[model samples]
Target: MPSGPEVLQAIDWRQPWLAGWREWGEPVAQAVADGLPLHEALNHRSAAPVRFVPQAALPPGEAYERYIFNSGLCPTREGLHDFFNGLCWMRFPRIKTRLNQLQAAEIAAAGVAPLRGPVRDALTVFDENAAFLLAPPPLWEALMGKDWQALFVALRPLWPQARLVLFGHALLEKLVYPRKPITAHVYLAPPAIDTIANLDAWLAADLGADKLAGKPFVPLPVLGVPGWWPENENFSFYDDSLVFRPRR
Candidate 1:
């Protein structure tokens, strides 16, 4: 019998994207290890915004998209993917809803492009590894330049405003093995400090899609955060002159 953190501790925090969910995965991991189904557990949560449907009884294939779109019921299949997805939904309902709307529209429009259009690409990235980043212009510039030190160290005090949310199930699935380029989309917004208590709710703020209009999601190397990844702690990883060297 393993504790929640113990089960989640097995996940590699060295992976930056996963570093975000290390806190939220506890309950889910405990549930999983206990052989408890999340679908039933979801119902009991009075705070849960949407209902969970394990294997969502749909007509199979694309038809299900329309149902989810119309019903607002999040599809919770099996495996770690759906489990993590459920947690993400609980954490980031607004962003997740907006993304679902975008994806469903794309599916309806082009019928799922092989390469995916811009909207779909954006949606996919956010769905898997989006981070809620709030930073001053300098820190933002440092991030854009891939200068980890300036972004995480020199700008440490401003960190309270700077939050990151990992709201993607695919991110967790990938972290099961772990790898580099821990990708995340930096959604530039200041979260409600007191209202949203946890990373899950902070990521799922009650914001609308229009808020993100014209604000292009800046791609980020999530591992660059100071203490987010273990390797990033001693500044060893930032020594990569090829990628993180400050621009002259």
Candidate 2:
């Protein structure tokens, strides 16, 4: 693995939001720099360097209060369990263009064969988190409208050990129904982050290898055409950021 500085440099870290994250994320970086194991820092979010603290490390009586989950208009509205599998359609044009930009020598240097159009398109939206926002209002009414508080109350018993942290633009749904009950268990963060540049880092920081190993970061089409509203796989919330992994 590359040193922290080298890893940071390999990617363009010029975004201003990342700067804000510095204060919050330092502890995380420090932990990685210190050679902490992956499982220890799996789901913790810190914007700076720090040591890892496993969930098991916490006092048995004291439950973990923080959980981060990104909620969205998944392909399957009700359970939406298989949503992750349908996300690849979002990576289109961009990945194709990126691949096309490579010179034959560059392709050889990269040690990967050029992809066929259909295959590229298939993989593009494969692991997408894009369609979440496109979910019909009826779906939002069913989920968020029921009130996050009620949902949490009912859902908590199923997973007693975990606290729920929702990661998505679903907070926007609150505006339509401000009276909706909010829950202590439900937390939200701005879903907009430039994913093109940060997908790798986001996975590195959020999911870690334990969760993301062998996974591919497929993009989603937030916007598409008629048959595929907000047409075009390239235009998506993913233009800013995305979550590419098994839906779980």
Candidate 3:
């Protein structure tokens, strides 16, 4: 593999929100530096390997979690989406595995539904457009609403610790095909995070509301988050007046 420092320098992050990914995704660069393709790099042989099964090869939903437990990977095909998903597995194995277990357990219990159960819905939401938000409890509801002021202005002090790591490929892909109503998957971080950025190494301890101020948050339409447009300007996806507007 290329020198670790070289790996860090090569992978360009589009936004600061993804600084965690940039900092933590050194393996991606090391693999690249060593001339490893995406799939090989991701599913590299380990004590536990994540299998990249073709869509046709996958069994029913009920067996999915069992399959993951047995094989340490759920089904995924090759593509940019699959590629990013692999990166997520490498970055957040525990969280990803837990999500799979929940999903598989839900499927095993209720089977697939046209509308889906709350558990499945929550999992899907997290998988699709969610951001793994590491912030305080006071910021959870506000951050969920994408309240910029509550997060960054009035509660500016939180920025020293507030972090948002994305786990959704749809949100990542939207770096190109931008969209809205993109919610942050806020997961309250514990003190362990102050030292390392390993999502796999995270300990889920909700940081409840301490003495913090509330502020009216400015609703910022999240699109073109960062690194999408070349100009490096503060732009919003809602700028396309015809495509998006306030619902009246």
Candidate 1 wrongly placed segments (more than 4 Å): 1-25, 112-115, 153-161, 172-180, 191-215, 241-248
Query: In model 3, what is the error at residue 60, expressed in angstroms?
Result: 7.5
- TM-score, cand. 1 vs. native: 0.72
lDDT for each residue of candidate 1 in 1-248, tens digit (9 for 90 to 100): 22232344366655555555555566566665566666654444424466777665555664455667877666666566666777776656665666777678778888855676666666666677666666666777777776677776778677666656555677656556554465666766554553434544454554334444444676666667655657666766767765455666
Per-model TM-score versus the true fold? 0.72, 0.20, 0.61
Please tell me which model should have the higher TM-score, number 2 or number 3: 3
Clashing pairs in 1: 91-200, 92-204
* lDDT (Cα, tens digit) per residue for candidate 2, span 113-189: 44523333322222222122212333223234433222223332432232122122232122112221221112121
Best by lDDT: 1
Worst 10 residues of 1 by lDDT: 1-10
- TM-score-sorted candidate list, best first: 1, 3, 2
Count of clashes in candidate 2: 41
Show the colliding residue pairs in model 3. Answer: 131-185
**lDDT score at residue 150, model 1, on the 0-100 scale:** 76
Model 3 residue 58 CA deviation in Å? 1.8
**lDDT for each of the candidates?**
0.61, 0.26, 0.51
In model 2, where is the ten-residue run with the lowest total lDDT?
A: 65-74
Residue ranges of candidate 2 with Cα displaced over 4 Å: 1-14, 17-25, 44-248
